[model samples]
Target: MPDHVWWKRGVIYEIYARSFQDSNGDGVGDLAGIRQRLDYLAWLGVEAIWISPIYPSPMADFGYDISDYCAIDPLFGSLDDFDVLLEDAHRRGLKVVLDYVPNHTSDRHPWFAESRSSRDNPRRDWYIWKDPAPGGGPPNNWISNFGGSAWQFDEATGQYYYHAFLREQPDLNWRNPDVRAAMHEALRFWLRRGVDGFRVDVMWHLAKSAAFLDDPVNPAYAEGAPDNQRILQVNSTDQPEVHAFVHGIRSVIDEFEDRVLIGEIYLPVERLVAYYGDNLGGAHLPFNFQLIHATWSAPALGRLIEEYEAAIPEGGWPNWVLGNHDQSRIASRVGAAQARVAAMLLLTLRGTPTIYYGDEIGMTDVPVSGEDIRDPWSLNEPGIGVGRDPQRTPMQWSARPFAGFSRGRPWLPLGRDFQTANVETLREDPQSILNLYRNLCALRTEWKALRVGAMKMHRAEGDLLIFERAVDDERLLVCLNLGAEARQAELPAGLGRWRALLSTVSARNAGNNVEFEDTVQLHPDEGLVAVLTA
Candidate 1:
């Protein structure tokens, strides 16, 4: 591990498209707006900001459908604007990790357009294409992430192309050596431009089963004819050959000191570990989605924490992500009362914590009316509610027009609760959830123990979350009132004098007791952190 890879022990803040800020009054977020927010991010104590894809695209899948990997989309800004944003972010001690979409390319890409134009074109094999079966239909029964057939027929070429996501975005043929080389060149180009790292999109799908074997039927979706339901197995992805390609990518990043690669892999822990490779040269971190699967119950979360701690491979760094642009916001999933607790849990954990943008202000997902939906997933699966549009709404900066996102109408509607959840309103309130996040992040940065300390669950039970974050003899006890009631915990044996470091609610200790009983009556949704003294 390089000593200067700041991301190893730092926090990553995620910024989503069409939501962050609009610079040109186009009702869309652009690089200039992001450039303007660098100081705000620096003050928040995040080490890096991972912006969603800004590559030139047709706006079919937002920015994920890329028409040109190396060019900036006009909707966002020009290439020069991106350069300015990078320079500004670097000056503020903030790293920028761009989202790299290598698994696929938009159908409008010249390469794809040419491939679709003729079956014998040089780029024909660039994308996964096949002749239809004897009946002249899709090559196979594979399903898309948005649902339905994964194959799209091109009458001009009389062949079908594979797309793991939206049909407009065709999956690239990773088996082709030229494709890998080109992708590597693109990565090197960005690194040369001063990008700190890349957040690989759909990393696991980069490799597929060589034989194109049909997947086994999935039993989970037998009940409904739901479009999101997948009957075929994902065996085509997560192939053994993927690591060798990833190793090549790692080699490129390693050449540039301090550069890192974070993969978005949605697989079991055991398989997810493979992304780290045998040596320390694979992806620096494979995002840990345990928080998504973890239930609010103490016993369940406790067991998961233990398992996660034991699963990380040596030499491979660890990272935890609570929310991202693709998923529902944490507040909506865990409830507003639990949001503060979630923040503490993230900051105190053993690995690098990733904070989704707008989470600091407790942003909620907007309800997307079917008629107003733009997500391809939702459009494809109209009845399944599979679209993630609500979660990807424009960020709330203020309660003004377009939620202060743009002078014109926003591409996406602002959250209905923006009046109360805007950043401007929260920034003024010391007790606001946004301030709580700022304080917690500041403490995490100032204290080495909070950054890279060992964590042991003290007494995690129903409606009571307790953990001891320790380094050497210094220990900090974090206790939370998970329920809507007052809670108390008896100081462990050998525990000494303690001082309150931070608390979500007001608290005070009893003057004197031989065996100290640190009882704090907390109001609903309150949590506390006390520095252990000896």
Candidate 2:
């Protein structure tokens, strides 16, 4: 808890708890398993770990459908195990961020059960329950994120309750002051337990339109596209009033010392920065997922970076996300070679970087066959190729059976190349993607320019992107070749000499002082970090 914010400079590693490790000889990963792997994470040069949900749940949405806000699930471990894990992580100089799911609660939860038991129940307003339409259909045309109508009819109550993802997960009524106090106490409970921070799940979906209006149809939606995209969700999401609740959450976080609040918002850069709130009262960081959805070309990504850098509020901090449990792995989105380049860019960008679990070792999407699919989103909508099971496969720890993830049968299947693409195997290879990530992370920590300096895009076109990181007189240039063809990039003049610092191409390329020729040549899929010296 230094004066300098750790969230602003530290690299956060996302550990999908289920896929990370299984210490109890069970098929699934647990909190103890994550604690066991802390040494490896410390060696990986990450300063924080953002763990996915381990809260008490019905597992309807893979821990996203939380049943209890203040307790850990028995499947993961008990509260004592969690406290022990938190202590170990903090002892290793790592901050632990929990996934906060406030938008919905499992229908099996006592609160929801009581809310649905009677029409005039005291806690009925805690959940969004609306009367059916005149024609006995859904209240409106709002769609569920998973699929189908957002409303689910309750035969017992003769009403429809709104669930954003699954029918089992009923959306909470954030407008209710009682609900606010309850959720805030949940946050305080964890803060009191010494938990470092929270990454709020579906933060943008917290406040819905009070008027219960129909969303406008999306003209761009096609015939076979996902049902959720059929409408623009103008009325259902990003409501201006959402900020008031977020401000309240910020006030709760401010009560604790040195704790961060990160919102999982998928909005455009314009709206994303707004989560910084009026006078920085909102989320400490509303995740910048633009890189996850961007086209992997140089000019396109460069413009995206420039636009995101420009869109940040005056004093707001920035963050970048390349991959996550929900999105396609970077190695699969771009080619395997370019994932190395992506690692360099992710670490060098003028923002905090959150690295997905297996991405450092160049893990790609492990295809899930018909019989093995576990994601409800895919099971709900079969053949659109939108299943997330591919990305949530077990982490490749070593070349052993089950990729050393577990001794028991894995809950999910391992990747095809699990024997070769693993941390234990790649960590020893100096030229491997894992080492490239280690080196880049080390460089980011070693240089103030890379850690917290201003960034300027010098050249961004075609297959080459060149940017400079500077703080006062200390300067560093980053040159990236995104395509699979070698290209000569023009260098900025009067920057003194270029001393090669780090390269994704090879370990030998670093430390070779490339004399200024007004231009530098880069190999295909190469990214170089060079320091300018007098």
The count of backbone overlaps in candidate 1 is: 0
Candidate 2: regions farther than 4 A off:
1-3, 515-517
Clashing pairs in model 1? Answer: none
Q: What's each prediction's TM-score?
A: 0.95, 0.98
Q: Candidate 1 regions off by >4 Å?
A: 2-4, 134-136, 222-228, 506-523
lDDT of 1 by residue, 267-320 (tens): 888888889997766888888898876787667777787777778887766788
Q: How badly does each model clash, as a count of residue pairs?
A: 0, 0
Q: Kindly list the per-residue Cα lDDT of model 2 for residues 1-534, writing each as its tens digit.
A: 232689987899999999999998788999999998999999989989999999999898899999999999999999999999999999999999999999999999999999999999999999999999998899999999999999999999999999989999999999999999999999999999998899999999998999989999999998777889999888898999999999999999999999999999989889989999999899998999999999888889889999999999888888998999999999999979999999999999998899999999899998897788899999998888778989999989998888999999888889989898999999899889998888888898899888888999998899998999998788999999998989999998766788888888873367565555368888899999888887
lDDT, model 2, position 167 = 96
- Residue 7: error of model 1 in Å? 0.7
Tell me the TM-score of model 1.
Answer: 0.95
